[model samples]
Structure formats: C-alpha cells, structure tokens
Target: MEKAGLAEFNVKIVESCLVPPCLPSPRATLYLSNLDNQPLVRTDSNVLLVYEVCENVLPDPAKTIREALSKVLVYYYPVAGRLRKKEDGKLQVECTGEGVLFVEAMVDKSLSVLGDLDQLKPSFKQLLFRFPSNTAIEDVHPMVIQVNHFACGGFVVAVSFQHMVCDGRGVGQFLKGLGEMARGHVKPSIEPVWYRELLKPKNIPVHDLELTKEKIESTSDSWIPLIYKESTQMSLTLDFETVKYVKDGIMLECLDNCTTFEIVAALVWQARTRVLEIPHTQNVSIFFAVDVRRSFNPPLPNGYYGNGVVAIGAQAIAHDVINQPLSYLVNMIKKTKMSLTNEYLISIIDTDQFLLDIYSNQANIILSDWRWLGFNEVDFGSGSPVNICPIYWNENGPNISNGFVFVHSPKRKCDAFKVIVWMPPQEFNLLEIEIEAITNKYVVNGSNY
Candidate 1:
C-alpha cells in the first residue's frame, strides 16, 4: 500500500486569464436559498477529467473550452460572480460578471506514466490552479479550470467549483453545456434556470440563536485550525454481475426492490463500524447526499443547476450496526431514503435543526454517489472522458474522516463501479479485510480475487 502523498509530476502554466461571458448577461444580486446557504457547503470542490488523444485531430482543448466557458457563462452568469454575506448573515451571489479563472498548462509526463489515475493522489492537485495563500472561501473565485496537456497529446480538465453554487448534478449540467458549446453548438441543449426563490424556505430561521451556530462558526474563514493529519486512500470494485447477484440475495430478506447504492452503502457502513472498533454502546451514523431534482410536484426545472440535494442519514448502536445481518442494514438505508419527501426537504430548509443533527457526530461516515452523475458522458469534441475523479475530499471537517465517494469505474464503464475511501493507514488495512469478508460472503463465495 502506498501513502497518499505528492507524486513526481510538474505542470507548467502556458496561459492563464479570467474568462467573462462572451455576451452580456443580466447584472443582479441572486439570493441563495436556505438549502444552498448551509455553512457546510461553503468550500470548493475539485474534479479531474482525463481524455486520450482523439484520432480526428480536433481543435486545442484549452482554447475550445475557454471559448465555450465564456459562452456558457452568459446563461450561468451567477457562477461568474462573487459571493458575500447579507445584513441577515445569509449568503448571496453578486452577479458582477467579473468572469471565472481559466488556465492552460503542459505536464511533463504522459497520461500512461501517471500509473492508475483512477485512485486520487495529492499531487493531482497540481493539475488544477492553486489558490493564493490565506485566501478566504468568500474571496475565492466561484469557478476555476485548468486544461493540462500532456506530452502524449492527452489532456486532463481539472476544475474547482464552490459547493455552495452547485452539487454533483449541477456541476454535470454545467460541464455538459460547456462540452456542447465546444462542439460548435450555438447554445446549450437545456436552457439554464435560476429561480432560487422557488426553493427558498417559507420562513428563514436565524442561525445565531440556534444550536447550529457553533458548527457554522467552526467552518467560518477566520477560524482556521492549526492541526493537520495525513490521510490514506483505498478502493473496492463491484462489477455488474456481482452487484446484481448481491442485490438479488439481499432482496430476499430486505425490501423487494433494493438499489445498488443502498446495498453497497450498507456494506460499507457495517464494515467501517466493525473495523474502527467503535464502542458497542455508542451510536454510529452514515450520511449521504440525495438528489431531489424530481422530488418536487412538477419537478425542479430541467436545467435548474443549483444545490438541489439534501444530506440524510440513519443512526444505530455500533453493536447493532456491525453485528446485524447485511440485509438489516440495507433495509435501514432503504427506509431512510424512502422517507425523504418534498415535505421533509422543505422542513429541513425551514429549520437548521436537521442539519445540526447530521453533523453532530465526528465519527459519522459520509458518502456521495457519483456513479450516475454524468461526468463520464461530458464530451469536449474529442470524445467522452476516459476517466473522471474528484481530486480530494473537500467536504469533511477536521474531526471527521476523509469519507467515501462512489464513482463509475473507467475501465469497466457500465458494468462496474469503485468505492474510494480515505482513512489512516492502519484503519484502512482493517477496513480492507472487513470489505473482503463481505465480498467473500456475498460476491465470491470461494472464488479467487
């Protein structure tokens, strides 16, 4: 097992500039919805899309993407703006049309020499632009992109977007539009919508008087922590057939219809609780983000690229979570997921109590599902990306673990997926053994790895 540290790679910047909308967009202030204004989402998220050289010899990726980004910004103008706190201590976007940061760079090594690009490495951060030292979250750009061209003509489009502006689905929609523009489309297929008022709460509660105030302040810009820890990475792959087989087996004892995410999530939560040796009398929870785009009456508009997902989780005693049958855990997750309705989401937005509970425990495990987020389908003229990966775990706080992200396997495409997790090295080794036990009990049954 290798440590998650910087690799021997260098990226030389060839060009860098701010790209405003190619056409004029409305200049106005957009108030963020209560859901989008969560202090937990006040940070930036990074992603990398690796592409091989196309045979047709298309236009330069950086130029094409830069031009396309400017065009796309005309519709998503809020993304080109800056964020600030209002008189009520809530966040809002000032549509200044100042533009986003774009950079073009050249890497010394070819994509092949980078070993397994699927597993995230700390050095991969170099693929994206580094923020200025001591820059506050509000002071950072809403979006930043770096197109790294390799010696083999392959390239990686590394991007950073503020989580407060977009979730997984929102980012996917934006990238799809960019790809469309690069391919010579005059406009995006689905028009971008920005009716944040539609998602606003009936009555916004004051956070300063609530229990969430402390949690919110901890994430504030001025309270940087002095301690840091080194994290390790691990992954487990489950192919189509094995997943189907496990789902079928679990359904026999669990609900009639269990999703792949539920089954896998259950396995992960149980294995982690067992390996961490958490006290049986204590409680453990698993939190995950669920996209609520279609949960509304008429459904959020086709192109409403905002933070439309809500974080929900299930809690249980450590003993029960680890000792119970796998089907029991699967059913627990399914029930929690099925309980989320439009009314439930609305209540969460209206009150800060729900969010405080979700983050109340530092030992909780957080998961994000990107298997169907549509990142692999984003084509920038050449073709769909060969690999898409989150550069690091940005959502976790100092007390929490690095967490897990479920992504589609680049090599297996539709038939397989990978679960990327981060933890200390010793704990990671025990986690692998626990995961292997689950695979042996459900997927292998005696088959070799």
Candidate 2:
C-alpha cells in the first residue's frame, strides 16, 4: 500500500482541524483570501449545493460509495460551518469546535436510473427539493454520496452541500480533486488555498452606489419557493448557429449587443410577464448568478474551494417587460449586465446589514438564468447530463412568479444547445406561442438566419 497518498490526505485533515473558531456565525467567519478585495459574503441564510458523481466500479456499491464520501468529507470539513450572530456587535464564532457541523449524506430512492443521464438529471434535481433543513449543523457530515447502480452496471453519485459555505465554482474544483483521488491520482497539482484576511471590509471611504432602497429591502419576498403546476420534460435541439441567429434577431431589434443568455432570458421574461399580467406600475426582476473568480485581485487559485459568485438582477415594470420587442428586452438585459460592476456588487453586500428590512416587503416576479453558468457538466462516469434543472428550496410558496432556465447539450447533437425552462403552468402557456415563433424563425432562416 502506497502510504504516500494517505499521508498527503492526512495533512489536509490536520490543517482543517486547526482552523480557528472565530466568527459572528460559522458561515460569515470563514473567508477566502483570494476574494479579499471582492464581495464574496455569505449569508446566515442556508443555500443548497448539488453535484452528480459518475463511477465505473460497481461491486458492493453502497459501501464503496460511503467510503468515497467519507474520504471527501475529511478534506471539506473546515469549509462546513453555520452562520450565527453574537449578542455583542461583533461577528465571530466561539473558538471551541471540531469535526463536521453542516454536512450530510442520504440516499435518494428516485435516482435508480443512474445509467441514463437524461432521466438521472431531472431525478437528481427533485432530490435536492426534498432535502431537510432541520438537520443539526454539528451532526451534518459530508460524503453523503449515494450509489444507484443502473441496469447496465453503471452508477450515479449525487452529493449535496450547503451553499452557505462554498459557491458552485468552489465545489466544482473540489469535485475535480476528489475525482482525481478516486482514480488513484493523489497529490493533486493544485493545492487548496485559504485566505480570509482579504475579505475584511475596507476602512477608507466607501462609495455610495445608487440602488432602489425599496428593491433592496424586498428580497425576502423573492425568496419564496416557486410554485409548480403540471411539470413535464421536453427535448429540442438548436445548434450554436441557430442560437446565434435568435440572438442576432434579438440584438438587431433591441438595438444593443446581447449575449446568447441575455436573448433567451429576455424571451422567457417577456413570456412570463405576459402570462402574469402584472400591473404596469409593478416591477419584475430578473436575477442571475455572476461568477466572480476573475473579478478578484490576485485572483482565486484554480483549486480554491468555496463560494465565489454573486447574484445580480435587472428590473422593469410588468408592462415594459411584456410588451417590449425582443431587441428592446435584449437592450434592457445588456444594461443590467453593465450595471453589475465591482462597485455595484460591493453596494449590494453593504445592504446585507438590512436584509430583514428589505425582505419584508419584497414583490413577486423573479427569474434565474442557469443556462450559461456551466451547470450541465454533472458527469458521473457515464457521460454529461442531457438536461439539468434547478430545484427551488425556499419554504415560502411562490411570491407571485419565479422561474429558472437551463441550457443543456443536445443528446442528438452535442454541438447544439437545448433550452429547458421550468415555470408556473400558466406562464409556460403564455410563452409557448412566442417560443414557437422564435424557433420557427430559426428554422426558416436556416444557418444564415
């Protein structure tokens, strides 16, 4: 037995054990050095993190799966902590703690279709929806990877984590390291880096960025769990060329340069707004996650493990959003993108001091774009998922309307992208005609269109 790998693993375990217990809450205390200058703040509120694991070895699957997860947890321990506020005005954790506090593992009975990536993707999503919130952070143990062997002897591994500790990109890097370890490739080239000093708030005069105080206070209303009615899966293939055509039409009409995500998102936003028929004076917001890896000074290491993204939103009145041409919508989206600069992100974080105040009067109508965010790379050993959908975990019922759109690689043609949207049934119906029109236009225009 090559003790070398074990020795290296032990080193990580010891380092995690030595992390100081200092924080207002476990969530806010742990900070990344690389994201020091940037606003990578964690909220006391919990977030769900999910991943799909593919494996080739299948004998005695349950035990094998558990063993793998156990080893992975040893590396992820320090990053697992709960967010808490102290009685005094200070923010820090009591320095007397050890072992895992906010990680768990459980079997999802629905993941039996491990061999079929298409079916497995959707099933995995539903699994995230059923995750319990009452589990003790101290007892929550990671490596809850589940093994569901398919009829063909292949198996899928689903690992869920709390987003309060790490961001998606951070988890992705961790999984890549774990995969290498499982494949007998230890001593990863990329070492994990922990830098909390950089994240400390600046003492100099902070700029006052202009944002709707009312909108900032209303995020709580937007946090409600989405309501779903008659959800079904559909598959369609639109290659990059077709995607480009649709994007071009939206840009030409909107009088602005819009990314593929912006165009598709504008379409969905318009469609949903139409169905909801919200009051003209009422505003709707489109929320999207922005990756801030490169936004930091010195930049995060390729192997950093933690949350490193921020949520940015664009708002418009219901009538303005619904009745606008695709081009105008695209322009609106473009402006929203430009507004998410470093100063804007910092201003948003500053508003966190009043989260409860803002969330109390939040309005309805929010959209999340998961298409261009690299969520489809969930490959266990079989292959990448044909479709990956997001599950809403908020406790409150839909606050009017909410939706998530994911772009997946087409099963028939890998080069093409397939867009699958999840939303309230009525909204889906309203957008059906416009969606078809866009698709039909793409077909008629062919590659050139």
Report, for every candidate in turn, its global Cα lDDT versus the true structure.
0.76, 0.46
- Per-residue lDDT tens digits for candidate 1, residues 15-134, read 999999988888899978877887567667777888988785455889889999999899889999988888898888998899999999999877875554544455566787857646
lDDT of 1 at 73: 92
Best by lDDT, which number? 1
Candidate 1 deviant stretches above 4 angstroms: 1-7, 203-228, 357-362, 393-402, 412-414, 444-449
lDDT tens digits by residue: candidate 2, 184-297: 444333566555454454533346555646645545443333335334333234467657777766556656666777766776677666665566767677666666656655
| Superposition-based RMSD of candidate 1 using all C-alpha atoms, in angstroms | 5.0
Which regions of candidate 2 deviate over 4 angstroms?
Answer: 1-65, 70-74, 79-131, 135-143, 212-214, 218-241, 254-256, 350-389, 392-401, 410-427, 438-449
Q: How accurate is candidate 2 locally (lDDT)?
A: 0.46
Please give each candidate's TM-score. 0.88, 0.69
Give the number of the best model, judged by TM-score: 1
